[model samples]
Target: MKSTPLACAFAALFFPVIASAEAEPSGVRTNTARLMTTDAAEVIDAPVLGLQRTAIPLFAGLAVDTSLYADALLAPNLGLRWALAAGPHRVVLGARYTHFVGASTYSGIVESEAPAIQSFEPELSGPSFYGVYGLVLGPIQLQGEARYGHYTTDYLSFTGGAGFNFAGHWSVVAEAGVRVEGGSAFRAAAGIRYGGEGLGFGLGAAYVDLSDPALPGESLPVLPVLDLSWTFR
Candidate 1:
């Protein structure tokens, strides 16, 4: 069958293969690295593994990255992250004010998990700040982050991850994080990431224990790790 030009154009416009000129993998890349930007900065969403984020460049050596996925209940959140310019061999430094918030600001009564009733309202928005550091190698990226915040609960978590670009626009990524303060919580995931000049996607399976963290042999949540983003350079 002969394909029409219109069909080809439509496919090209929306289904182009994902690829990027930069490291593309998630990490705190150095300023000296190719296409270096805070676009790789860590957000509170998936922590070490990050999630959908947008980095608005504010200066030559700094950019602010924020994400809304950090809060599962859509609680009012504010996250600020800065990527301090550094060389590829040096650590890229930055910080977050808080994560972003979306809707759910009204006050009302809600149901609890125990079949209990409860009321909800916005509080004085707690303090949430984080320090991020990352380094980029040609096809390898590494990052570490620590965050302190309290929304429904208080936590201080440390996370570190590594990514290896094994093929064009494809990378193998793994991350592990733990909350040492407030309570014992743990998360670890290994997945693949895809990136184009602007769009990116991530998928993997993760183990998340929010209360007393213990590894369950075969009982794992499906689709625990998922990320999708379209960034504007």
Candidate 2:
């Protein structure tokens, strides 16, 4: 199937997950008491991926030098995120689209040799899928998530993170895990979160490295990312 169509389908799947997570926020529907978000307003993470900057496709098998903007290496590229609480349990769902525009250029040119600049632009787009299930215990919260995508050459990843809600409306979260398919590797991230009433937001970065030594000159090891979103209740 075309990448665009497949992304649409994947994006559609997140809605229900958001609904259920929003309905209850604490424990297994049957076990443990429910935990819920203290605020009712929707939250959006302006910086996604925490501190990481770039993610390369392991399956591509080729090295290409591309500018960050030309690469469209960012998320919430255009996305909608939603979350809900039930007592102390919570569910969060996010959907995002990432796009890359490719171009070519010639640095120097002589009068008779060749044109000064030449380039081509190709459309690159993919879908970002996110789901999180968590249980709140006192001042601490534990959450596990599964993420997959077709936005950057079909990849799958999983992560687990913990959050601490301190005095006032401030919280800190840290996560670590592995991403597979194309080029499998381990990634870690952490960031601060803030929210109140009907609004929430996060800022952070992430790091990713594929285990294969043969692919040494792959892409950059550090990927810097930014995420932003708005929720409607």
Candidate 3:
């Protein structure tokens, strides 16, 4: 999914600050990061059949007086990350794979619905490589990273974000970027991280907005993303 301007703001607000004071946590040198998540959604209210022609169609039928349609979506992921420490800076890199499962079906229809309620089970996965430069000052840590990758359907994307570390173990991260291949779009994301030794975990979401490739002028959008990972020694 892609991110919106608002998502970036939330990540920035929640992270990049210190709430507690304590000694820097040890074991920040090993694997350093990991994440995972599962999700489901339902869509309703339509006079016709088949995928909606525009992004706005997703919310067109959410009122109290519309017919209801239900669909299930699942996204499962896995990742690994490592750091190469330098004198005053550190480099962080990683990769991820995501699968979108389940399907969208139309139920409760009594008569012929042209095209009928169909099923869509699409999957997106690829390698994401990134670099982060880190600096330590007193009890605060600051860093920046850039990433680029292509998914299974020949979709390419590039992203970059910054983060802050508190006492070395806990951190907040935010990213703003874009995706382009045949078409172009924008994205934003944010999350929290807990890392030590060869283990780490994170939670966050992203949103995306762009034109509908299957339709003209219309837009297709995805939102409310959750990301998770794990690092091995």
> 69-133, model 1: which lDDT tens digit per residue?
65554643444444453566434454445433433443332223223334443443566666656
lDDT of candidate 3 over 30-86, digit per residue (tens): 121221111001121222221111111224322111111111223344434444545
Mind sharing the TM-score for model 1?
0.60
- Give the whole-model CA lDDT for all candidates, comma-separated: 0.53, 0.48, 0.41
| lDDT digits (tens) for residues 1-233 of candidate 2 | 45797788887999889887766433211000111211112222222221111122122121111123333433224444556667776776655666543322212222123343242233347776677777777657787777777853687887777766664556676777777765557777766665443344556666765333433344565654343322222
Model 3 clash number: 11
- State TM-scores per candidate: 0.60, 0.49, 0.43
Q: Which stretches of candidate 3 lie over 4 Å from their true place?
A: 1-83, 92-155, 182-184, 196-199, 210-222, 225-233
Q: How many collisions per candidate?
A: 8, 39, 11
Q: List the residue pairs that clash in candidate 1.
A: 19-196, 78-98, 78-99, 79-98, 79-99, 80-96, 80-97, 80-98
Q: Which prediction has the highest TM-score against the true structure?
A: 1
Arranged by TM-score with the best first, the candidates are: 1, 2, 3
